[model samples]
Target chain A: MTTDDLIARLTGELKPVPRTAVLRRVAIGLGSSLAASATLMYFWLGMRPDLMTAMETTPFWAKFVYTLSLAIAGAWALKRIAHPLGSIRINLALMGALIVAIGILGFMQLAMAPPEAHYYLLTGHSVSICTLNIVVLSLPLLAGAFWILSGLAPTRLTVAGAAAGLASGAIASLVYSFHCTESGMPFIAIWYTLGVLVPGLIGAIAGRYVLRW
Target chain B: MNPVEARLKELMLASLDGDAKSYGVLLNDLARHLRFYFMRRLADAHKGDADDLVQETLMALHTRRATYEVDRPFTAWLHAIARYKLIDHFRRNRIRATVPLDDAQELFAQDQSDAAADRMDVERLLQSVPAKSRDLIYRTKIEGQSIAEVAQSTGLSEASVKVGVHRGIKAIAAKLKGGADDDR
Candidate 1:
């Protein structure tokens, strides 16, 4: 074969990568995050033995209103920063906003605590606080990692990132379960939401660099 | 028995006898024959898919050899596998046959034989290119892919893909032009 022929033949070869796998990974991340949130909410309800009574009171209603406002704002920030299309600026911005939102939420919880406090509210055996923190902190980190990793065009990087995020989340969730035996269902829903969010964010940031495929 | 069939049978036997390395050598040689088989019909010689099909077939053979019946003629089974792998490759890559049934007979009988000549030329060229160059060539041209896509798919640095693609193209071009130019 002559050089020109070889060049022409070589010029025509192209590799095919499958798109379906990337989409599946993203779907899994979203489902996992939603489940973590539900668990946190379950434990939250158990923490405040008097939460139902407080719900009937003015202060309880006020805190509820405040928390609801924070929730909406957090959701908005999440959408803006984690734009579905995925740009670096949008991602970093999203992470920064989420951290701020979580900080505010932690402070608000302390503020809403009653002085006469149910032993559960103060040094509580309640699973509510722990679940809430874990869920809140972990979701973003793990979710971000999985979403970003799977999108990279390189099969190896995508596979590696996916495996790491999935394994870590599984491990972390097990560890959290042992620590939050007292969390109310609602607490678990909220705190676990935060926990996952943190790891998800870390994963996302790391994926941007590693999976540049 | 045909010489090719006898060779393939020998290759299979060697593979089954625990000479795993011989299987690869057999597949490499078999790929050349497969290329010739497809070249008779493929119009675009550079449509690197023939090679892809050959590789896919070899993979299927390796993975599913245990199912092969010793009592059956080896050529029949090998040809069936080759045909199946070719179809599988098309399905996976979304390639379609443009000639409908109404046009098929006419196209087969009256079509220009240009594609066959080009396919032969391409096969010769491909067989001579270095392995690395061949891979890059296959990724860029036959796959009809962008450099970024190729890099992403292959997990190579973008710089490496760029350099490799350029070098590979130059080398193939040089080889095709014969020994006349040392410009590369």
Candidate 2:
């Protein structure tokens, strides 16, 4: 049909679109998802025995800051990227800077520690379990992210998914930290970061299939 | 810059708020724009598909209207969707639509054709790209060479060649949009 003909037909069939309750959905979705994950972590694994003392330690706070920063950035990016024309370049750059800072701090701590303690710092008390716990805890958040994104029109699906995964993983790491006993700065910098990024990679791969509208 | 754009943005925002009349007008204006946009990019042989793309783009905009950010520039969002529809068309018929060199020459030689003018516009836009990337884009886009073929001819990995071509097109689009500088 001609353009004018198509327009006429479309106009005749036009229906009013309801206002999108995106902001409300985001608040409720993320808030409840985080609460559920936190509750599960609290009851299932229990808080670390020295929870009060850990709160006072700089290392513990460092880990918290690291994960929380990622969580905030990723969440913010996800919100904007729900639009087809949204650009996440700034958020991605900030995230990159955070990684570099963490990496530098990790190496510095390693340098200061004695040679014999190097392996202990690198290996940590919990390697496999920490990563797995972060991934598991991120499930609810990831689901929430998917819910938020799939409801929108994100053209860059892989990037949107990666942002969602990053947010989920970071939030998971923050909750997991309450139960984790590891205080090694280097270990947190390395393994904790990996835990968050692993899900990001998974999200990127799955985005093509899941977010294909 | 123009009142038409400002008017379109207002109509779009109104449409989001359930103003069916404004939505219809907005879609009608967008359809006209898309017809021109698609026609400029497509060859004469594929001119029929321009209307199809316009229809498809409008349908997408209708369904995804809820995602539109009122604060952002409307044209950017509109163009992004239009570009994706164009890309989807190219990908769907890449093998069949890749014009041979001889056919491409004939197609461009006809100065009277709108396709030839569009081709010239594309070339001028692409002049901003570095020499190497321009050649890669020429081979892949105009010559219709596959990524593997381009890679083999240039002795670059298929991945890099693909990236180069993608970046080149993106750069050209950016320039066309009046972006200050090339990021790549």
Highest-scoring model, TM-score? 2
| lDDT score at residue B151, model 1, on the 0-100 scale | 87
Residues A139-183, model 1: lDDT tens digits: 543555445343422223322443334333333443344334433
Model 2 chain B poorest 10 in a row by lDDT: B99-108
How many clashes in each candidate? Answer: 90, 0
| TM-score for candidate 2, residues paired by index | 0.69
Question: DockQ of each candidate's interface versus the true one?
Answer: 0.02, 0.30
lDDT top scorer: 2
Give me the chain B TM-score of candidate 2.
Answer: 0.52
Q: Candidate 2 residues B76-103, lDDT tens each? A: 7777777767766876777245422221
* TM-score of every candidate's chain A: 0.36, 0.88
Quote each prediction's TM-score: 0.27, 0.69
lDDT of 2 at B136: 97
